[model samples]
Target: MTFAEITTKRGDASDGMATGPLGRAHVRADGPAKITGRATYALEHAVADALHCVIVQSTIGAGRVVSIDKSDAEASPGVHLVLDAGNSLPLVPKADFFGNLPPGDTFVPFATEIRHNGELVAAVVADTVEQARAAADRLHITYEEAPVVATFADPRAGDGNPVEAMSKTWGEAEQALAEAPVSIEVRYETPREYNVPIEPHGLIAHWEADDRLTIHEPSQWIDGMANQFATWFGIPFENVRVVSPYIGGGFGSKGQALPHSAVAATAARMLGRPVKLAVTRPQTFTAHGGRPATWQTLKIGASEDGRIVAIDHRGANETAAAANFVETLGVVTSMMYAVPNFRSRQTIVPVNTVVPGAFRAPGKNPSAFALESAMDELAIALGMDPVELRRRNEPDVDPENGKPWSSRRLLACYDAGAAAFGWSKRNPEPRSMRNGRQLVGWGMAVGTHPVYSSPGEAMVRVLANGRVEVLSSAIDMGTGTYTILAQTAADALGVPVERVEVKLGDSRLPRAPVAGGSQLANLMVGAVHKTALAAREDLIALGLSDPNSPLQNQANTLIIEDGMIGPPRGPAIPLGDLLTATGRDALEVTRDTLPEKERTAEERLSMFTSLAGMERGPGIPKSRHSFCAHFVEVLVDEDFGTVRVSRVVSAVDAGRLYNPKLADSQFKGGIIMGIGMALLEEGITDPRNGRILNANLADYLIATNADIPAIETISVGEPDYDATPLGGKAVGEVAIVGMAAAIANAVHHAAGKRIRDLPITMEKLL
Candidate 1:
């Protein structure tokens, strides 16, 4: 099974047969509308008589509010109401993190107790956004500040608790490390990062009546948001509606409902009017979670022949004092490679900051940095080619649970990427490759992310006019969800791509999993595929039973293609004509894909405990993961010590690609984000006051067009049918997993400088 084989099975219109779109490079359906500014985002929706709301944040990091004087704000012009602890809707306590029980204190916004700086304290609703901002500024508040433990480095920071179920030891790691002939130990640090999507978090909450709440917001998890609001307000779940047709970008930031959304909903209900709140650029840093700061120390031992004998990874990540969200630093460590003995310990260090949440690869990003960099170091110790070292340690079964892999084509990716990037031309010696006062270096590393799928439901309708519509609560988030889903329905229904329509990001539609973890593609596509097949079968049955139909009782030889149904090789009849003959306007079917339904409640809870994938155990006989290899070239200036990634070749094995064009873009996007993590992006927190110094885009750096290099992406491997019915795995996040390490290895090769800390800035090189 290879990419070539996958391409052959892709649907073909040439032979007059209908098949699902599996490996096509179709353009995004939403691109034209988005580029022309005709697409409506969450904040772009219009509502009559909607008041604007602005939030006031706490100045102190940890404290108790002494007093709040809202008199001036109440008297301000156009101020409809000022909501604070003194007067706000009381919310019932619900299980944290979408009802997945965890050991942590649950909290809501508009509290008098300050947990961290920028905590939501009050909100002002007025006739306009400017008036709301003015009133928010006029509110006088005083706080009795307490001492703050800002980060993992703070002396007051606790030793932290071991992450439950995440920390485990297999075999005798210490004994194996001691007996191994070769070994290396290294510590790597990654700084706090924020998900500053193009469109900041915003919401417009409206109460149509006392019991009904409607929110037009950008949400990655529509059903979760509706359920959360329903739980908070003690209303029926059906009464809460979440409508998010389009989003600017999410990158995991919009997966969960933050406190600001709650404040807006509260204000809207209190004022008896609609309230719109757009989180400012700076507030987005603390309003929702991002990638947490991590400290990882890895000890790897190998034989002289480069076979990994032992690996011990111990790490800590910063979480909020008010929440329990630990970065699973051992996510990729336990199963990435073939190590006979493995040990991992993950600790959660509570800091005076916002609770960290998902950011793209989340746990795997930082974990891969440490483990992959350590592998590079081990390769240096063994005097072996990095690619060869990885090939030698490739596992036959999952090292964590001894399960066979559904699909493991990582070596193929390495081969493809290395050949494309001209790896054989490289000189492995550090600082040996030079060109005109600049040093060139080539480096490569393994990339991986787990495959996850939750229950998803979708509705497919084939109209009498020969058009198809697929509806689901899943969102695009600029990931081509609409395009791929439409393609899936069109392929399944034997129709042209142009005749399929996709409607998503609304709770009123069929339910879907959250758009994070790269799981929506598998779940939603499978649901659409099933429902479309059922609809086609229903239509064919109608044609057989209809007395006026041209082809009755030809079930075995019937074929549906190009919106026409007939016996193979003859007498094709239009689908619209059959529907008219049957006295039916359309055929519709709704279906769901529930892969995890057999798991117990406890097992289900463990799946989303920290946004990691399902645990490998006896019930699951196969370990599923998407694999890639990144070959990076970096240039180092002789005088200034600035490093730039000149080019990248990322070869990915994500089962079967539904849309190669979109997959190509997703690969490049993740690589560019990896560049930011390696050389540019860092959230500078003022430890003294627990304030994020670089909160705005001007201060918080990201990879722009000027920083990007030429990126080449190659798709590899066959469809992993064992993992999912669609034969596709997670695609987006794995590209960023090993990127930072590859760039760091390139830096060391170019300048002979090893900087363990993230954002390998010029000062460290100099």
Candidate 2:
């Protein structure tokens, strides 16, 4: 399917060609509002007669509630109502994975069953947040505790159904491993991690009538939330509206409509007043989704020359018993390198914990940590440079399915990043390079993420005043979606970006896919491109039909530039003049853009069949993925076991960059998060009670400004037209996928101790 070609020649001198908005650096459009504190988040939404709600949670991870006594709480001053399971409205049951509802049990306030620690058991609504918190603390609750498995190592964790794709084999990996000249078997583990977005989960729900509801939420998927709310309340989908114009961050946590949203909405309808509920930071640890802890065993066999012959990866991840969301840990192993005999498995261990969901890069993050580290270990055993080892195994096509990459410049990324990070000067011997008391070590790793795009709709309108407006329901999540959309519209419509206004984050706008999986920019921008083309064509048609127009019948000769419509050699007239002559206030067009159905169908079939451990067919089909490479320099204190990242250089091949500034920001953000994952961040749980031990910011460690060092991001190659009209793939997730592996590899080079577990803490090194 060919789209309207919108080209930006590198050195064009036309008045409309102002350096082309693509591949340029620009300040974020929302920067002023954000810095000045004028931006309103979900919890900041104000409504008349809005009440505050505080949820009361269960102390036990698994249990049945005996009784809830709310007498003192209900009688407290300023308390409006105390609601429990017996009094609160019943909600529809949650569906399977990727459902509209959150990935957990349905919201049953004060329910008999407590599925996990910190499960909401009741709620108190009052005149203010303080009063609600005060009253909620006064409620008395009792529970009948039940035995629970809190970790993947527990024998009972294997009671759930085995994930079908957890175990698969393409050839006789065992025999190949035994015959190989060199082999290594290693184990790696990563602790559970939380998606601690700066803004906690919050919702402000208002019911205009019994059937009409409006909710302000920090939701990454407003459409999904609207659908879930409508279904739960038995109302028309159109009657439920979600507004989330600004979100501090999501990182995959706020994408679903959690139980709290329904509880708040139900309370608002019952009281005939708006209710605002914001989960405290502590509640976010257990209430919202997180990355599950994983344990992996990797067995790799290589020839004497460092060519891998057989690869085996087996892993298990913790998950809530109610959720079937298995992290795709083994999926990356099949695509990373060229190996004839390969086997991979990912087991889902049911543990008493919060349901695990997609944290940025999800499966690929932990998988890369295991696979890439193993590659380094194999490189060491084979006495070869790590980079050369990877180069030797680089597949001309996808190893698993024999598919040609739409665009894979992973090799180029390594080349560019290695040169920038001075990888040539590194010593192969461990603990050899040092800077005084700190051991200096350099490491590199390759990163990749599947290119994902979904159908999306967008509306474009050219007003009588010659201003253009692009509308969609996509979210920003601080990733600069608004800025990029404006750039796309400005470039497509031949207007200054300042004159093009982009509106988003409302369910009433054109439909858009969820703003996760790094797909929102490509999907929404493609829709806008199509919409702008339709609107431009409509303007030309209007000018040709207008009697007052000079080129009334020369539609083919017309050129639209800088809001002016005219023939290339004739007098030009403002677009407003043409609209005025046509007696129209605005020309509007809406378009829905979908991925190529045949290609999508083929890819889906291949993915599912491969997951089922079936044999792949012959021939090299088209494959799509974003690639990246990270070169990290870490300074490890030989005596104290303190590891500090000194420098990082990342080269990415994500196709065309709409805004280099925003892209660099995203790269840096991902790298910072990766540093946290490798050195400091871990969700600690109390084994005795299955409760999060350190849920607050003060206790839980993330990479702060003081922890970050110099980070350099380089964009590689031209835009890939085969991937999307914008010629871009996802950059949001890939940067972090291989980061931890790189850092861990550097630690091995510095300390000679190969710690396979994450957060490479001092205790382990000591």
Candidate 3:
């Protein structure tokens, strides 16, 4: 209910314009709480008489549980209960956040059959977490092993099923490629990557009654998961309450209800005691999904002048047999350039592994790696500068659907990024530029992600004490969502940010869409604006109707500025005074809003089935997308095969800057993740048994402080009115798109070796 003190820098407002703290950089309202350890994350919520639950996992990759001997664990001291497939309560299968049956729903926990390794076999509840873990270890389990198809490369795992929805061909790509003067054909592969958030996945389930359930879990989509949980327990949706005030990080992993949560809730109801379950860091690998492994074969044909002629891309990603959550790689490939002939086919390879979920950029990230790397190869085939090649193929309209862009400044991004990164000083010849014994190289790639806004709701209340409260269910995944939403509400209500209190991450708050795909800002901002506007109007009406009001009978030109309501060029009365005179304690308004335009049936279906945003719909003549260009510098050791990212300069065109400081952090964070993708991070799975070898942080390498270098982010664009009322696009995912490709291209320029596969490792280079 409380936020840290907000720091704001205010400027003088004009007579008609209210220059509140909307675009200015303000300190985060939750900074003090987080730094001082006052912010409560999911597992940190303590409940009285709460028993700890530990899940026993199946050892075999793919198998059927023959028998589970839980008598020893049940008899252990401090053990409350030991529940397995034999004694588990029946739960309903519910749809996931995207309206599809995820593995958590399709494959019930404690079931006899196991789809993959680490499948939940039993749940042990005890007085303490240590006791639960000890009891879980005492349980003996036997499994009948089955042949496992671990990955797409396995011959047993046949060619994956074609994702018919993602397959598309506009022109004769084969014929165009055959006749083109310059063509390049290559294959790229991105390995599985895990989301290693600072805080692991955890949940506290307290069942007040058989019909009533309350869950305290970290979530990105509170409303979506609350409904899913209600369905699972066969309880009234209104009876289920989900509270998540803060999340360390989600990155799409916490967007839906996992099987572990359901098991904990069931345990709580059976024991008549609250249950707390925290997935260990090692268990997180198989407990939730991660970025799936993908293989893409790309063929690009270009003219002598460096214009792209044709693009043929066939992509496939690994998925769990129980869940058909495939990455649609064609979305980014079809629209990136102005190719006359373009063809794409996406497939999902069902393997005995954990179900794949959305990563930061999801399908778009690997797709960008394939497409942009191919573009760089195409540039090499035509002997053209990569930047110039992209410029030559820049499209006036979207090649996939023939729609104009809301605002595309890709060329401008390239210019700005190149200038900032000193692109002009680079030598064109491979391995020609060097610093001492190390080779120096410069590389660049274009980045783009669709702008999306879902239907959202917000409640705004203006109290007579000159205080404002903005309430929503949308959660911030360390993306500055709280700060940005507060700024938006304060700007619209003509109040200082310090007086505004923002409440979020609770299912009981006004409904909101999932805070993924970088869509929350546009979604909640509009809702907050509308609700604030309504409240402002109510205050103005109260002032105009009051007989003693100084602004009586001035409804025609009444305006609110600096917490004051009056005529545009005249003296104003304080909003608190109007409320005091009217004997009203507060003015409250709740607004449920849709996107700027109505979504088409197709768009709505896409939203439910896929994480993709609106592509073509009514009242949307333009294709709304954010664009950026990343210029990277790299140094390669000739003998040790070590690659280091020296510096990076990324210029972005994500429309108006809401919070420059936050945006810069987002951009640099993504670049650091890109650095990891290029040289460090990889999820190693044993193909023999489908077991993740590097599940723990000690083995799973990510970019550390020593790995990161100087990164500069420059914003370049005006307000895009066609996108949203706030005039801003998605910045979260766009910064990471095409980033890996930029680094790979730089490696090729430095070492004269085109390592097409991802994570340009030392052995691969050697």
The per-model lDDT (C-alpha) reads: 0.84, 0.82, 0.84
Clashes of each: 0, 1, 0
Best by lDDT: 1
Q: Quote model 2's TM-score.
A: 0.93
**Which tens-of-lDDT digit does each residue in 301-324 have in candidate 2?**
999999899998888888786566
- Off-target runs (Cα >4 Å) in candidate 1 are 1-20, 98-108, 553-557, 595-618
Predict model 3's lDDT versus the native. Answer: 0.84
The pairs that clash in candidate 1 are: none
Comparing 2 and 3 on TM-score, the stronger one:
3
TM-score, per-candidate, Cα-based: 0.95, 0.93, 0.95
